[model samples]
Target: MTANTRAPQQERSRATQQRLLEATVECLVEFGWSGASTTVIAERAGVSRGAQLHHYPTRAALVLAAVEHLSERRAAEIRAEAAALTGDPEDRVEQVIDMLAAAFTGPLYVAALEVWVAARTDLDLKAALIPLEARVGREMHRLTVDLLGADETRPGVRESVQATLDLLRGLGVANLLSDDSHRREQLLAAWKRQLTTAIREP
Candidate 1:
């Protein structure tokens, strides 16, 4: 009887935590770090401030947890998308390029950009965030390599692959405020051609 009750209670606690974390990301994406106060997060989560504090005592703690949650959610999404690809070479190239490009421009990137920009001045936040960013970077790199069957061991292959992601990330960040869609589209097309050519190296 006690075990049955405990399991349900534990599940409820997990659900509440998940709601709080999701709300944190929503706040970060919409209003940035300064606006994502604990009160606002609690209200967004539809939980009481006391309940939120019980889960996460500090702003950095709450936001950092949200970042980890976002990384896990996004990585799973990328993995599923990668697994669903068919084996046609031309189709795969287009699909993979589109996936990588889309991944960098969406809500997940916006939420992360908010945290990264805030972390620039907050040493404590930076300390907490750097390892999470590194882990996510590694996961993204592995996902890209697998999605494209990239031969990372080939000469210059690894650096080129890293550069591709870096370029997309920079472009994604730029898209936050710019309306340069025409130029972005041109650059993206050029990148696709270059990546396809590089991958076909003898």
Candidate 2:
């Protein structure tokens, strides 16, 4: 009942929620969707089943929250890297492309891929994921434009930005089966040249 006691309880609840989200991602990556049950995630998080349900209620909820949580974290990291870029503006553009490339290949992408595949057959999950994906995609596009100082008003500039995202997403899909890093770097290098030209044209 005391304020002090309530604060600690709230902090612990947040911590548990965080742990469950992390564990859901890990389960998806390691066990796939069918394997990432609520029970499994709770066990992975070292939290009780009751606690896990209290936070997320269902597997889809947990997985979606995990994806959203990690997506924000990843985007924040990209923004921070963009802030720290030095040297010529053109060079900074290249760095931003590389940062976006890294985002596609990271753990978050891997976990989200698992969910994407599962959502193909699960209507409830597909419904939840559609809006989340749309929002994340918009944020990424906005972030990319901001990082590149791109003028969407310019002809082809918006398309060029969208193409960059499409390219990165394709590369991420290709990377699932094997180490596509070498091929990915080659493709990204080529796309950067094209993107730079597209966005820079008068």
Model 2: per-residue lDDT, tens digit, 1-202?
Answer: 9997999999999999999988988888888788888888899999998888889887778888998988888898998888889868789779999999898987788888888888989999999999999999899999999999899999989999998888888889999889999988887888888888888888
* Model 1 C-alpha lDDT per residue in residues 101-193, reported as the tens digit of each score: 787888889899999999999999999999989998998888888887888888877887899899989888888886656777788888878
State TM-scores per candidate. 0.95, 0.95
Say which candidate scores most in lDDT.
Answer: 2
Candidate 1 segments exceeding 4 Å error:
none
What TM-score would you give candidate 1 relative to the actual structure? 0.95
